[model samples]
Each structure stands twice: as structure tokens, then as C-alpha cells.
Target chain A: MMSTVLAMAAKDLRLLVRDRGGLFFTLAFPFLVAIFFGSIFSGGSGEPRQLQILVVDEDGSEGSSLFVESLDRSEALSVELSSRVEAVEQVRRGKSVAYVALLPGFGASLSHPFAGSPPRAELGVDPARGAEAGILQGLLTQFAAERLQDAFGDPSGLQENARSGLQAIELSGATGPQAEGLKRLLTEVDRFATTQDTADGQEPRSGGQGGGFKLEPIRIEKASIIVAKNGPPNAYAISFPQGILWGILGCTAAFGLSLVSERTSGTLVRLQSAPIGRGQILLGKALACFFACSVVSVALVIFGTLAFGLAPSSWGKVAVAIACAAMAFSGIMMFLATLGKTERAVSGVAWASLLIMAMLGGGMIPLFVMPGWMQTLSNISPVKWSILAMEGALWRGFGWDEMLLPCVVLLLVGSVGLLLGTKLFRWPNA
Target chain B: MIRLAGLTKKFGERFAVRSLDLDVPRGEVFGLLGPNGAGKTTTLSLMMGLLEPDAGVVDIAESGPPTDVGVRRKMGLAPQALALYQELTGRENLRFFGRIQGLSGTQLDERVDHGLEFVGLTPRANDLVAQYSGGMQRRLNLAAAILHEPQVLLLDEPTVGVDPQSRNHIFDNIEALKAQGRTIVYSTHYMEEAERLCDRVGILDQGELLALGGVNELIEAHGGLGVLTITTEAGEVRSIETENPVIALADWNRSELETVRSFEMERPGLERVFLNLTGRTLRDT
Candidate 1:
């Protein structure tokens, strides 16, 4: 039985190799896509892209000027000083991704121990540039966290206050006012320990009658950004996995169409007439498709590694992720093959579906840059899970624990599809 | 030997093959004579266990129903359509089917080579099947079926659309297989091929067997009359059907027949038997 399966698989592989069109889409197409998308996202050297952020400092204070200088020195953000109206207009016109504004008298607000509610920086951004806007917002928040923490007087002393305050709360096991405030402070201290505090999310306050300043929380104009101290991974590292997935999908479409072709050509009936079981026959075809899809994915990874310098965080995890993804797509091929009676009908439907899946799954456009609703909807795409798994393996530093969810989802898809395909499978005559 | 005991199959509301019973003795050459929708392919599929019988069982040589792997291994089928992968060489396609039939090692190689030689495709075995002429592809399809040398061979109109040369080549192969004492069930719409090859024939129509007997026996039993075609030197042609050819010829003018440039006399064949039984041409659906 095993030998029969292998023979069938070997025959399919031979045919797959002979099919220049399938190979072209499965292998070469991914490389071209990777190059095109990767080069567009990165300069192809795998270095992180510098986000251009225009700054208009209306408060001619030392602190405001210092903030602009620091933005220019940061590795991720490229800052340009511009007038408020010009910067806002540039963002509105799509000329720039975002602009940060220093509200008037921002310097005295920070210099005095909270002279009033800490002056907020007005961040005007173009929503179309969601990814770049996210990064710029994170940078601005980090800067704000640093200034807020500075208002408390020495960093070590503040951290000591936060650390001991947490110990007091723990020892007391109390829901007292000091502990509640300290719990929030400890969360802030954790952020502070990493780099700068969660300044974008910090609470600022005006100086009350007390000798020290009371912090008041300031909002940064509806901006929501999570500060990643390690910064974002290089764009190619992100784009290459999507390219590999496109290659896998291409093979899935090819193999799915091949099944319909086999039935139309009557070879499927010939195989059914043999001594092999239906399980063996479908297994052989599934194995063949799986191998083809896996090889395309692995080849793209190798190309990305050797040529584009994509160093995945863990090779073992990537292999497992790719295996799961290939299995899912192979099962999908079987399912789609059974959907239509004719070869042309199957090909048309399968390609259209795969293209839509790719579009929604970050194959055609990056999910990060899409609108909020679109990004949320993309979560439903299996391609998104595949991309997430692969990104985690490559640059997200996803260990097996983090990789298990996508792997499970992918395997579930494979199992369900395999069941449907097996149930619905038919020969040309039968 | 193969047998279908009260076998049945249905498509939607209609029965494709209903309560069909058949037996083909070992080493017998049985041809399924039918029109387009006569359920020949459905019966073959059920017998191969590629499809399940809706009501009854399909048993082979008392081993078991065709669902048994051991029984399945004993039979081979060459479908009406060419089943070879166009992208693969003839050798590869033969080798693949050979391996599926449980042949491997040097045994697989020798059998594939023998099949290629038997089908007269050895010279071009290395070429892709897409590049092969229609006749070559038809012959290669035959080779793929018989590479494992099964005891029972089911060929379903193996030369449906091919040039005359290819058709003749296929005829030769089928005849050779019959000569080898392989129990054969061949299906086709062509009457002459069945007349020349089948030791016994079953005429099927509307999902039922209309007639079953030796070809000559059927012709003698149901044949209406023999057809006579005469062509004059002026390229004019005429056809007549008569029960007694000798008397009919005697009644005709000798000079008129002498002027006939070409003459053909077709004896009662499967086509005539089918027409007599079903009152429809073999090509009619």
C-alpha cells in the first residue's frame, strides 16, 4: 500500500516538474514577488525603514526644540521642522505620513513642576499611512514618557519609590488608596524599566499646594501606539514570508486544478481501477501536493536567507509552521478540486478564491497598512494566521508556545478539508 | 472470471444499470455492444469497485466482490479515453501503472518494457505522450492497462477517436490480448470491431441487456438481411438489402452489375443485431 502511494506520488511529482507553468508560479513567481514587494518595503538590504515625521514646534522653548533634535537622532524616525499649517497640510495632502506639534508654552509646562496640566503634543496623522503613523506615534509617546518621568525628579529615586511601593502593597495585601495608585505606578515603572516610561500613556498633573508636582494625565490627540523598545523588524523579513505563502497558494491552485484535469483525462478512473484503496489514492495526491508546496516555501526561505539576509528567529519553528501551512493548503487543494466537475471550471474558481484569500491575508497588501476595519477582518483569513506564524518564527521571536495557536488552526483546516475532500471525491466516470 | 449478481446503480431519479446480472467465463472475449447511454461504463465502474452497487453485489471469480483488494489486483481496464499523463513519457506512464499493480524492481522494468513492446510503442517510449500521434497514444493507453498482465481485462472503447491506422493498431492489441486467454470485456459503439473480436457479445440499451450470444449466433438469430453496395463506373452508387443474395443477384441484370466499379456485401453484424433488438442505431443515445 505504501509503495503504491509512493508510486502515485512519484508520478505526480514527475508531472509537476514537467509542468513549467506550475513551477513558474510555485517557485519563480514568489521570488519575483518577494523582490518586488521587499524592495518596495525595504531597500532590499533587510534594514529597517526610517519613518519620516515632520515636526512643527510652536512653543519656542528649549524643551520643544530638544524634542525635535531627539527625533532626528532616533534610529527609526526622520524628523523635519516645519510650520504647523504646512505640516498639517502636508499630512492631509499625503505628502508626509504624520507630523508632531509642540503646543504653545510646552517648555514652561515641563520646566515648572507641572505648571498646569502637562501640555499635550498635537499629533496630526494621515490614517492612510497606518503603519508609519503607528511607528511615529510610538516614538512621540516614548519621548513624552521620558519628560513625564523626569518631572518626578531623579530616575533612580522614582524607581526606588515605585519598587518599594509595590513591596509595601504586597506585604499588606491591601486594596488601600496608596496600593491602588502604586499598582498603576508599578505598571508604569515596569514600562520605565524597559526604556522610557509609557510616556504617551502616562498621567500628567498640575502643581497643587503641595511642594511637589501632582501628575495629570494628558492625551496625545486620539493616538494609540504600543512602544516596542526593540523597534520594528526589517520590512523584507515581513514581506518574504508573505511571498513564500503566495508561492504555496500558487501550488495549491495548481495541484487542485491538476486533480480536476486528471479526472477529465480519465487517469483518475484508471487509478481507481487499481488494487489501491481510496485512502491510498487521495493520500498519494495529498502527499504530492504537500511536497510541492513545502518545497516552494522552503526554496523561498533559502532565497530570502542567502540573498536577502532574512535570518529567522528559529529554523525549527519555521519548518513546523511551513509544514502545517503546506498541509492546510494541500487539503484545501483537494477540497477545491472536488468543488467543480470540469478542469477549466475548477481552475477559474480556485484561482479566484486564492487571489481573494491572498488579498485579505496580506498577500496583495500589507495588513498593517490597511484600514482598521480591514485589518480586523483580515484576521479571519487563514493566510493571516500563516503570515502571523511565519513572522513569529522569523522575526517576532515566537517560541513553540506562541506558534501553537496558528499551527492548531492550520491543522484544523487541513483535517476538515481532508474530510470534505475525501467524502466528496469522485472519478470522471463514477 | 467476473460476475455481476443483480447489480444496480442510479443517477438521481433514474437507474443507470438496474438489477443487471452477467457472467464472463475465464479467458472469454466478451464485448459490450451498446449505444451512448446504455450503462456499459456504469456496469464496468461497479465491477471495478470504483463505484458501489446501489442494490446488489459485483463479484469476481468467487474470490469476493470487487471491493476486495486481492480481487481488484486480478483485473485491468483500458478506458475509452486515453489515461496517460501527457507531460510524462510513455515509459513513465507505463511504469507508474505497473508499480500500482504491485510490480517493482527489475520485475517492474521488464514488465514495462514488455508492455511497450507489446503495444508496438517501444521505439518512441521515451517521448512525452503529448508528442505521440493519436494511434501511439491509444496504444500507450492499452500498454498502461496491461503492464501488470492481469487475468481479466476491461477495455471501454479504447479507440474511440483515432485515425484508421491507430484503430487498426488497437484492434491488433485487443486481439492479441484475447489470444493470450485473458478474460476480456470490451465496450464500443463500433459494430465491426466487436464482430471481429468478441467470442460472445452483450447488447445493452436503456440500462438493460437486449441480447447476449456469440456474434454469429446473434447475427443468425436477429439479422434482418445483408446489405449490398454497388458503385458504377460513372461514380453512381446504389445499396440494397436482401434475405437471399444469390437469388437477388440472379434477378439483377448481369451487365448492370458488371458495370459496377466497386461492390461490397456486408453480412449481418452486431450493428444489424443491435438495430433489430433496439430499433435504434448504435450511435443513438
Candidate 2:
């Protein structure tokens, strides 16, 4: 019995070697698809580019220069020097993100004591760089507050004194209190200047404040992606299932033809007269198909690995999965073969069924993108579970825990198919 | 020897073979003669254990069909259809079937070689069945069936589509097997083959056996002693004019017919016997 099975298997292998079309479909096609998909998905790892700014100082006085210097030190903006006209033109032309224009304070306002209004800086920004503009505005406001504390001398009284000074200047209608407030603000700025120096001296903020952008730092650490456990996502996972399905489909077509030929030729009648039992004869044929399907599965795995970088971590699991898949597929082929009376009928039905399973079960399309209902529907397809189990072992780095379900499903499906196949199998010319 | 008693087979609502009784003794070739759909193949299937009989039992030697592994080991069968693989070479097919029949290693090699030699396909043994001519394929098919050298050989129309030369070769091989004391049950629609080769013939029609007897005995009992045809130089062809053409033809002188190119006479062959018994030629449905 062993010899019979082996002999039939050997014969099937020989036939496979002779069939170039079968080889291409079972092996080459899957490897090619894997390579194609791998390349497409390869670039999913790396971080996204920072904004540049320019500051223009028109007033040349201590206050204008200090404010300009503060803006230049900001982490969010990379500050550079330019004339006010040049800076505005740069921002408008989209070369620099935004321009800071320190207005001419003329220093006289700060020389007075509580006599005039505070000086203000004008910002020229490109609205298109909305995120950068917002960051610049926030930094500018913080810098102003720090400068106010120094000019007022008393931290608690700074806000009130600044406000009262600006109000008096506005009421006088002569810019007297605002000029004094501006002078007082300049005197306070000198005191706040020391804090900037201290923080800068401390840790050299590597572009300051945790690398500028407020969101968590995006670091793309590259590691090999396993779509399944125990292996890298590669062609073998896809092709192995396809090979099993096609191998069985091919066997069905061939065996069905052989059966019809035998009946038409009358050999079934002759075999009937022989001493061998029908069970033995059927067993021999089924064994032949099973062996053939296994050969095809192995070939697909080997070539798929070589061509598409499919590497399974565990050979033992892969072998088991292939065996179960092959046996189940062979059973399906035999059962289908028995159902049809003519070779043409068998071929048509078998090919149609194979295509449907292939398409639905990730043979032609990845199951990841399949709709939820379709994914659930795939449970009934042996191709789906076979592919899942094989891929899980090879690409998904699946341990026994992850692998158990698919394997069990495959085994159950195989047993059912084999039982049905054997029961339904018919002898030609009987 | 093979024995089938009260063997019956049914297909849905119809009985293909009904309570068939048969005995094929050791060392003799028995022919199961029938027209199309006469349950000849069905009976052969029952004997081979390829089908379960609706009733009765099939025994090969002393073993029942169901648990007759020993009997199976001693049987060789050439199915009515071509059973050899088309993709494999003649030798490979023989070896494969030989292995299935329990021959292995050097034993398998020897059996394969012997079977190929017996079928006169030794020269084409390496050629794929697909590459062989129709007659060559038919011969190879026969070789595969007999690779195990069984005690009982079952052949179902083993020479169906072969040329006359190949048919003769097949006949010679069967005769050699018979001479070696192999029990043979041969089925064919060719009445002449049955008449020439079989020691006893069982005639079947419409799933029932019409008659079963030796060639001479059958003709004597059912066909009125046989027929003789004589052709003369007057461009006239006629069967011998007598109540018993067998007696008249035995006394005809070839030299007396000076204008006759050739004249031949013989006992009624299986074809004539079949027509006499069933009112139709074996080939005429």
C-alpha cells in the first residue's frame, strides 16, 4: 500500500515537471505578485520638514533690537536678518514663512518716565503658512510679557502700571504716559534679558522646547514587518494556498477526463472483473491526486521564497500546513470529478469554483482589504483558512496560540472534503 | 478457478445483471459474449469486486469477493477501457500497476519487463502512451493489466481498436497465457474471437444469458450442425446446398472446380451461431 501511494506520487511529480503551464501558475505567478505588492508597501516608515522666519529691525534702538533678538531666538522660527521691505517681500514671495517688523520706537519714549505710550511691533505673515504664523504669534506675546516685568521693576504691579500708563497716554492725546511707559518697558527688558541667557546656557535645547513642534516626536524605527506570525510577508504565503487549490483543480480536471475516457473506452468494465476492490482502486487514484497536490505546494514554497523574499521561521509548521491543505484540496477535486459525467462539465465547474475561492480567499486579493461580511464569508472557503494558516506561519510570526485556529479549521475542512469525496467518488463504466 | 453464483446488479429502477451464475475453471479461457448493454461488463465488475451485487456472491478460488485479498493477488485484469496512464511510458505504467499488485524492487522490475515482452511492446517500452499508436497503446494496456502474472486473467475487449496484425498478436499472447494454465475470463463483442479462443462461451443479451456451451456443442444444439459456403468460377457465390452444409462441405473437391480461384468451407463460426440463435448479427445491436 505504501509502495502504491509512493509510486503514484512519483508519477504525479513527473507529470508536473512535464507541464510548464502548471509550473508557472503554481509557482511563478505567486512570487511575482508578492514582489509587486512588497515594493508598493515598502515606503511606510520615515518623519515629516520645520518652518523658516525673518526679522527686520527698522528702529535700530536698544528696545527694537532687543525685541528683534528675542524673536530671532525663538525655537519655532529660524530667524534671519533683512530690511523691512526685503522681509515683507520674502514672506509675500513664499521664500521665508513670515517676517517680524519691529517698528521705529525712536528710544525717546523709553527715556521719559511714565510719560508716553508703549511701542508695538507689527507682524507681516503669509496666511498660507497658518500653523507657523500661530506659533510665531504665541512666542511674540510671551516675549513681550517678559520684557514688561523688567520695565515695571515690580512683577505684581507690571500689568496694572503698563495698562494705566497706556490709558493716560491715550487720554492726554499727546502720547505722554505711553512714552514714559515705553521707557519703563525698555528698563525692564534689560532685567528679563538675563533669564534668556540662563536658559540658553543650560542644556542647549536642540532647537529648543522638545524640537519645536508641540506634538510627540515622530521617530520611524525600522523593523521587519511580519503580516503573519513566524514569517515575513512574502510570496510563499500567497502562492502556497494558490498552488494547493490549483493543484487540486488540475487533478480534478485530469482525473475527471480519465474517468470519462475509461468509461467510454470500457476499461472500467474490465477493472470490474479484476480481483481488486473498488475501494482500493479509488484509494489509489485519490492517493495520486493528494501526492500531486503536495508536490505543487512544495514547489510553490521554494520558488516563492527565492523570488519574493518569503521566509518562514518554522519549516515544520509550514510542512504540516501544506500537507493538510493538499489533502483537503485533493479530496475536493476527487469529489468534484465524481459529480460530473463528462470531462468538459467537470473542468468548467472546477475552474469556476477555483476562481471564486481564489478571489474570495485572498488568492487574488489580500484579505486585509476585504469587507467585514466577505471576510466572515471566507470562513467556509478552505483556500481562505489554508492561506491564512500558511501566511500566519510564514509572515505573521505566529506562535502556536495564533496558529491553532487556522490549523484546526483546515483539518476539519479537509476531513469533511475527504469524506464527501470518497463517498461520492464513482468508477467509470460501472 | 472463479465462481459467481446468483450474482445480481441493479441501476436505479433497472437490473443490469440478474442472478447471473458462472464458473470459469482453472487453465481454460472462458468467453462472456454479449451485445451492447447486455451486462457483460457488469458481470465482470462483480467478479473483480469492483461493484457490489444486489444479490448472490462472487468467489474467486475459495475466497469470497469481499475479503478475497488472496484471490485479488492472483488475478490480472485488463479493463474494457484503457487503464494505463497516458503521460507515463509503457514500462513506467507497467511498473506502477505491478507495484499496486504487490510486486516490488527487482520483482517489480522483472514483472514489468516480462509483461512488456509478452505484449511485444519491449521496443516501445520507453515511449509515452500518448506517443504510441492506437494498436501500440492497446498492447501496452494489456501489458499493464497482466504485469503481476496472476493465476486468473480477466480481459474486457482487449483488442477493441487494434489493427488486424496487433489483434493477432494479442490473440497469440492470450493463447500463450491459456497454454500456461491460467484461468481466463474474456469478454468481447467479436463473436469470431470468442469462437476461436474460448473453450466455453456464455451468450448474454439484455442482461440475461441466452446460452452457454462449447463452440461445437452450441452450434450443433442451436444452429443445426453449422454452415459451409462455396464460391465458383461462374462468378457465383453460394452456401453449400444440403440439409447439413457441414456434411456437404466436407466432401467438396477443390480440384473439381477448374475455374475457382479459391474455395473455403468450415463449421459455422461464432458469428453465424449468434445470428442463428438470436436472429441478428453480434454487431447489429
Give the range of the ten consecutive residues with the poorest summed lDDT in model 2 chain B.
Answer: B253-262
Per-residue lDDT for B135-207 in model 1, tens only? Answer: 8888898888888888888888888878898888888888888888899999888888888888999988878
DockQ, all candidates in order: 0.55, 0.36
**Model 1 Cα shift for residue B240 (angstroms):** 7.4
Q: Candidate 2, which segments miss by more than 4 Å at Cα?
A: A35-307, A311-317, A320-324, B12-15, B225-240, B243-267
Model 1 clash pairs? Answer: A145-A199, A203-A216, A203-A217, A204-A215, A204-A216, A204-A217, A205-A215, A205-A216
Which one is best on lDDT? Answer: 1
Model 2: per-residue lDDT, tens digit, A1-430? 5565565456655665565665565445554555554554343311111346676666788866766676567664567889877775555433466676655662334322244534555666553333344555667667665554355454334444445544665676654443444434534433344343333233211232222211111111111121123223533344445554555556545554454554555555544444455566556666766676666667667766776576776778788777777766766666666667776776777778877877787666655445446767877787887776676556545567767877788677657766776687666644
For residues B80-148, what per-residue lDDT tens digits would candidate 2 score against the true structure? Answer: 667766777888878767766777889988888898889888998999888998888888878877777
- For every model in order, the TM-score on chain A comes to 0.63, 0.53
Off by over 4 Å in 1: A43-109, A113-233, B225-244, B251-266, B283-285
Model 1 TM-score (2 dp):
0.74
Error at A44, model 2, angstroms: 9.5
Q: Pick the candidate with the highest DockQ.
A: 1
Each model's TM-score, in the order given? 0.74, 0.67
